[model samples]
Target: MTIPKDKMLEMLHFLMLSRRFEEALTDLCRIEGKIPGMMILCTGQEAVGVGMVAALRPEDVIITNHRSHAHLLTKGADPKVLMAEIYGKRTGCNKGKSGTLHLALPEIGAPCTSTVVGAGPPIAVGRAFAQQYRNEPGITVCFVGDGATGEGSFHEALNLASLWRLPVIFVCENNRYAGAQRQEEHTRIENIADRAAGYRMPGVVVDGNDAMSVYTTALDARARAAAGEGPTLIECKTYRWRGHGESDPQLYQPKEEIAAWRALCPVARMRDAVRARGLISAEDLKAMEARVETLVQEAIRFAEESPYPEPHEALEDVYA
Candidate 1:
């Protein structure tokens, strides 16, 4: 599918935004010592977030994993509130209860961000089933990691989605490593999408680092699900520059491999691709980056200035 030039540029913007937001957040956690709780950033996996989110309709549901700031941001969450949530302030989306782990925006149909390995798939299946029952127009997109494939919930979710022909798009962000263990060491299969065959669902593997490729694949999957087709497993082979969390040591990762992936930076690649297409000039790219930088800084300042929730309001929005 030919994407509009403006939309392509917008995707590039979100890609830049996701990267810069995490960079700022990382600085806040490591250097400034302001952020609370364990922070996980999707620095190298911006393409999967921006591309897929761009492909979906606004009404569609999304369930994200632990590293989900990119997903929420690209899905149109307010940066100030999201950053404030990380800061555990009252102005946050979840009123600062979720922190960096389980960020959810139910008003936008992103009702869940499960940190449990492979938990997103099951929740996505349930949402898809509800959509199927009500004959909704959109599909559920579940973002999981390569590590999530090891969990039994992932298989069960796939099986149910297939059996009932639910409108769910299972996207596995295979970032080469599950925590510290390599994909080969933890799982026997070379590609995570191959597991879709067991449940009779279509599995499409694409370059997770390419925004256009991911968008195209996701667009097709969404179309299929909307047409009453079964779920599709889209394995996005990406790589994360940082460790699992803020406290992880990089002793297990090889310096050479990390350097090689860094060379194929998704944001840089998307910028170059758009530039080659004459969609954006270097000057415009710089201007866009400046705007994003300003936005991120403003978000951080807003979060820092925001107040934490009152002690008496702990159970205000809590559900059983």
Candidate 2:
């Protein structure tokens, strides 16, 4: 798949933006301690989010996990509003209620996010089922971790999706760890995508650090789903650069493993790939970095300047 130079640059920009945004969030958490909820950084997993979302249409839906900042940004959610939501400000995407873990922006087709490990798949299944029923063309993409594969809901959702030929893409961003426990500790299977065979669906595994690879894989899955071919399980083999949450000590992972994955930084890989093809210049890459820095700073300012939600407003969006 030959991607245009302009599009490749755009993908690189999104990946860089996601990384910078998370870096800014980390700094904010360290300095001001203003972030209202747990901070889960997607520093190294930017490629999967940017590549997968880039393959989808504007109307396509995506359901995400706790580590969802990249997913939201890639789906075209406003960075300022998302930052405000993380800061628990009134002008946030969820009116300061959802926080970092649960970001919901219906206007952009990302209706909700879940902090629960395996909860997102079932919701994606429900949304895809609705699309099938209404004869809607849009498909649902569910982002899950390796841990999710162990849950009953994951199996149940896949069974239903396959049975009904629902237009859903089951994306397992297998980042090696489910919190502190490594994937090998809990599951016997070598690859999460292997489980997809049980549901009678096509299963594929790709180098998650490679953005173009991920994009092509997602594009293929999207085409199949749009053609009424049902759900596909795509397992992206990647690694997380940070601990599970802001407060985690991260004793489980060895320093060497972390260093090795960092060496394969997705952003750096994409930049090198583009530069090697003479698609982008070093000056252009530096300029893009500067722009991303400015954008992140602006989002931080917006979040800080926004007001907190009023006490009475908490009950406003609730339902029985």
Candidate 3:
């Protein structure tokens, strides 16, 4: 499916915004020492986030793993709220309690997120079940890392989703590495989507770095789900630009491989593509960057002024 020029430009703009936000976060972590370290960035995976969000309605649900800033931004989340959350301010989306792992904005269908690997799939299945039972038209799109597929919950969620034909789209960001381990050291399957056959559903593999490809595949999967078709396993061939998470001394991979992945940076490619297509002028990109910078600055101010959680409130949310 060819996206209109305007929509493509919009996605490109959003992708650039997300990249700038991540960069700001990294700078904050390094310069201000606000966060302990840099986040595992989705630098080469912007297309997946952009494309998938394009296929979704405002009311449609989305759940994802720890690497989900792009998802939040694409869903129209305020940059100020996100930075506030990362800063652990009471005015954040989750009252500054969720941090990087658990951010949610129910109004925009971002219910919550999980830092624990593979937890999103089951939750997505549960959300799908609820929507289906309520006769709602919304579908759930879940993002998982390649490492997540090794978890038992991944299989369990897929099985249950297939059994009930839940409106859940399982998007696997197979960056070929899980934390410090390479995919070669993990499962033996040549393709993660191949496993979907066991559930009797469609298995799709797409270039995750290509925004149009991701959007098209996600649109197809979502259409199938809405039509009562079974779940789909979409393995996105992408790469990570940073270490797994903050404080990861990445020794498991080689510098050459990292450099190689850098060549396929999603945001950079999209910007070039849009320019080549004459969809956006360079000045337009500059204007968008200025807008994103303003929002980021406002976010920092908001986080600084916002209150922190009280001493006793932490225990209140904890279940025994």
Candidate 4:
């Protein structure tokens, strides 16, 4: 399916906005100490978030790991709410009860955030099973890191998702590292997508830095899921420009590697791609950036002014 130039530009702007927000958050975490001592960043993976979100309906669900601010923003969740939540404000999503590590926006079907590495896939598979059994058209998308795939639950979830043909898409943001360990050090497979063959499912690897490519691939996966073709495993070859978490020193990755990946920034690439079509002007791109900046500033102001959760509210929502 061909996307109109305008829509492509819009998607590019969204990717840019998500990237900007994440970049701002990294700064916020450092100077402002807004985030906890440790925070994982999704810096260079804007295309995966923007592209994947573009392919989903509002009612379709997304389940992701701790590094999900970009996904949340792409799904149209309020940045104010996100900032507030990060600040543990009562006005934030989940009443600010959950931190950056555990966000949930059921209104947009992003049920929850998992900080437990590979935990999200099974939860997403469960949601997929429920949707399929109820004959609902919605699909669940689960994200895991290259490191998470090493866990036992990753294989277990893959087996279940395939055996039942659950309407879910398993997306592995293979940034080539699980914390500080390079992916090659932990696995022998050339491509993470190749693992899908064991489950008898289709797996595709795409340039995760290309927004259109990621969107097209995710759209196809969702369509296949809706048509009862089960799940698809998508390995998005991307990189995170930041350390694994805010507290991490990141001495393992070479400086040259970071420089090389930074050159592939998804938002910048998408902007260039859209401009090359001659459908968008330089002024239009500037306007989009200005708007995103204003929105982010407002989000910061709102989060800064928002009230923290009441001291007595800690007893709530613990029934699990």
Each model's C-alpha lDDT? Answer: 0.91, 0.92, 0.84, 0.87
Worst 10-residue lDDT window for candidate 3 reads 31-40
What TM-score does each of the candidates earn?
0.98, 0.98, 0.94, 0.96
For residues 140-184, what per-residue lDDT tens digits would candidate 2 score against the true structure? 999999988889999999999999999999999989999888988
Residue 5 of candidate 2: its Cα lDDT? 85
lDDT of 3 by residue, 1-320 (tens): 56789778878878888888888776677656575323666766778888888888876899977888998889888888888888887778887678867888887898878878999999999999998999888899999999999999999999999999998899999988898888989989979999899888788999998887898888899999888886899999988877786467667768898898889888888888888888878888788778878877888888878888787877766777
Model 1 residue 267 CA deviation in Å: 0.1
Q: Rank the candidates by lDDT, best first.
A: 2, 1, 4, 3
- Candidate 1 segments exceeding 4 Å error: 318-320
RMSD of 3: 1.8
Candidate 1 per-residue lDDT, tens place, 9-41, comes to 989999999999999988889855588889898
Estimate the overall C-alpha local distance difference test score of candidate 2. Answer: 0.92
lDDT of 1 at 20: 93
lDDT of model 1 at residue 250?
77
lDDT of 3: 0.84
Model 4, 172-232: lDDT tens digits are 9888889888988989997999999999999899999988999999999999999999999
What CA RMSD would you report for each candidate? Answer: 1.1, 1.0, 1.8, 1.4
